[model samples]
Target chain A: MTREKIIQLVNQIFIEQFEIEPDQLTPEKRIFEDLALDSLDIVDLVTGLQQKFSIPLRENKDILEIRTLNDIYVLFEKLAAEHPDIVAKLNKEP
Target chain B: MKPRIAITGAGIISALGNSRQEVYQKLLEDECPTRERDDWADQMYGTYQPFAAAVDLPVETAKTISRHFRRSMGNAALYATLAARDAVAESGLSKEALQSGRVGCIISSTVGSPGEIYASAMAVLRNELQDLSSCQFFKIVSHSSAFNVANFFGICGVQLSPCSACASALQSIGLAYEQIKLGHQDAIVAGGSDETTPIVLESFRFLNALAKNPDWSPSELSRPFAEDRCGLVCGDGAGIFVVEEWSHAQARQATILAEICGYATNCNGSQISQSDGASIAQCMRQALKDANLNPEDIDYVSAHATSTPSGDREEASAIREIFGDTVPVSSLKGHLGHTLGASGGLESAIILEMAKNDTIIPTKNLTRIAEDCAGLDHVTSSRPKRLRTVLKNCIAFGGVNATIIYRLADF
Candidate 1:
């Protein structure tokens, strides 16, 4: 999938999970400070991403390094590049 | 010698209002603030007469609190924390003092996080356990309010969560009084809170414990001792008080609002819903004995009249047997509805409010006293009367009874 599609997917997840408006999803917005997301919300976000992408998010320290929404888009892009089937999986409904 | 327990500050979040001034003004206006909860009633019991007295708490109010404390909180815990913050602020107690764990906290509720329980149950049915959050268990735990309060204030002292149905809040206060009077603790934050949920309301409605008056306004439906009284109207809120030892408060120059002179708690140990009037009367007499005062010394009586036919009559009989028909009595349920666990704490705080103006707030919709509740001189209208000593009563399911005596503070 293209990087733009990955950004759209992450935006869709935030809108669905946190009830955040799409217009508020700035790339530079800090998840914890700007979006008012707490540790609990972090757990939920990681779990949602893992289940939808079928990736082992907790296996690596990648989740801890993410502070901004852009970090999430970068992680998804890396995962898609590493596993070509991930792009095809994202296109299909679970 | 018993240590003197003084109430330094009281904070409340109820249908009436959050501030003392707002609640007092509404009480004087003598209007019932309950609104018809039509959807709740329809969905719960297919009835049209459901009414509730609810507090409006904006999410922004909790923005400043720590995320660790806020993440796991249910509605009851949130309300308790708000009241506790106000009480601590009003008492002039320093943050270091509270954080030292020298102060105790006792808060009560009927059930903890019913909404959370329902949500978890639905998830289980759908086999969606993977999406459940970590905070869900903490919110639904039985001690949610008590634990949340301690965590919020960083209090390391005695923590109690009493669940005695309607008497839960008063029992908490009574226990705090005992702890202070016995010199085990110097100060305590005590109160109770309950979130008005559809399931809780449905349970009460199914048991025929809620009012069903079709013609009366929302305010008039919860007439405590009126001849046409039907049943209680469920309400929600939190009431908290900063109770300190007299010497401790005096040393800090804290304003003493009222002195908790005596407290007594008892149980019938037999029926769950049925009340034993004799047992309740014994509880009151025991409290009077503990206070070392005669029946005549009490200037006012706060009755636990919840408007149910049997509950009101039984409590009125208990009052008549203890203080006879001479003492003036009233119930705040007419204005606030039956707040369940929060009833005792909220009403007790309002009694202190009444003491400020030396005015007795009459039962909101009591037009004619029921024959079963006739002997007591029920205050039907607001009147000015000097209230130096007051007796507060709380009775609940499981035949639990708690009586507390308070005297006007003097230095």
Candidate 2:
């Protein structure tokens, strides 16, 4: 998926998970501050993204470093580019 | 200047019941609350078999006088409030004590408001931000339970929320004990609560940390230190106790359950999940040293075993290293599940009750002791035993290990 497409999906996930509005979920929105996502929420978010996109998002040492919406978007986009088919499927969905 | 502290009052709401007497009675009979399935099944990734000693908290209990109380308070906070109220009432400390504003409150939770977090997320997904209530935001915060309990009881003194994973409750009580002994406050209400949530269950499932025995009933699900034990079952509940200085308690004629003799806490500062045996042992040693007691002086140990493979093994090793092979070690998590932040508080309360009743409840479902858990005298079945001093140990997710020494009240 493209950067914009990945951002859209991330935004959608945040909105769905936290009842946040699309406009409120800025690229700079911190998970805990803006979205109120706790440690478990972050783990679930990554897990859900991995399952939905069929990407291998292993829990690396740096996995805890992802803090902002933009950071998550970049990670998702990078993964999507590596798996075009998965990105295509995600993009095709409403 | 460490003053002797006394437990003036205690209250609890578990799958067992709302009051201490109710929960204690149920525990004596080895009764447990039912493990129910999650309502949001499809949304959850793995098979969720969550069990909680859930309290039937009325809406009014959660509702605050402030207009900001619109958000649905988390089950943890709701339960904390209930237990705190009961604790205050049982202490028989007049409103003047609270009005004096010298009272403090410390509440802890392992996983705070998983349901609220999930609900908030679902709301965002449904494009329902405006529909969401204000209380939703308040519930998701880590300190929500502590804040709510403090507010509910009008306790204006030093308020704290400790999130040491499973050890949150113990640390909370330990800190309260310190505050009272140091004269920071005359009285403090402290304990912990946990609510079963999908995220907590799914996280454990992903790590393959939950039991998956179809034939094994809920009561038999958590087999801590058992050789054939698969994993732990998620159980939820809360425990709160009223702590005061010995002189204060005696002056008020408060019923003393046990004396908070000593406390010690240390962090491994290493891995986030795995237990460091050396640090765990050191914590125990330090607590014993602080209490001016030897390893043999401790009559019982309420272990921090959650039935997880690595966790149970590490704790077992630590116990053997510290207290030798003959120490009677047991975990209430097998009975109450891992109440997380509330585990420390709940287990401490249970241990005190055990000391008072002169009986040690069985480890519950420990059928075969694990090979790694060998050389330990674990109480596999409930038996009457006179316990004078009990050591309660708790370990949390962030490499925090805490131990507290409680002595039976000598009147």
Provide the lDDT at B388 for model 1.
Answer: 90
B359-404 in candidate 1: lDDT tens per residue? 9999888988999999998999998988899999999998899999
lDDT of 1 by residue, A1-94 (tens): 8888888878877887676779999999999998888887888888778776777787768778999999999988888988888688777753
What DockQ does each candidate score versus the true complex, computed on alpha carbons?
0.37, 0.02
The residue-by-residue lDDT of candidate 2 on B80-186, one tens digit each, is 77777788888887877875778899998875688888888888999855445445667888888888887776789889987778888888999999998888899
- Error in Å for residue B249 of model 2: 1.5
- On the 0 to 100 scale, the lDDT of residue B228 in model 1 is 90
Residue pairs whose backbone atoms clash in candidate 1: none
User: Candidate 2 vs. truth: CA RMSD?
Assistant: 12.1
lDDT of 1 at B404: 93
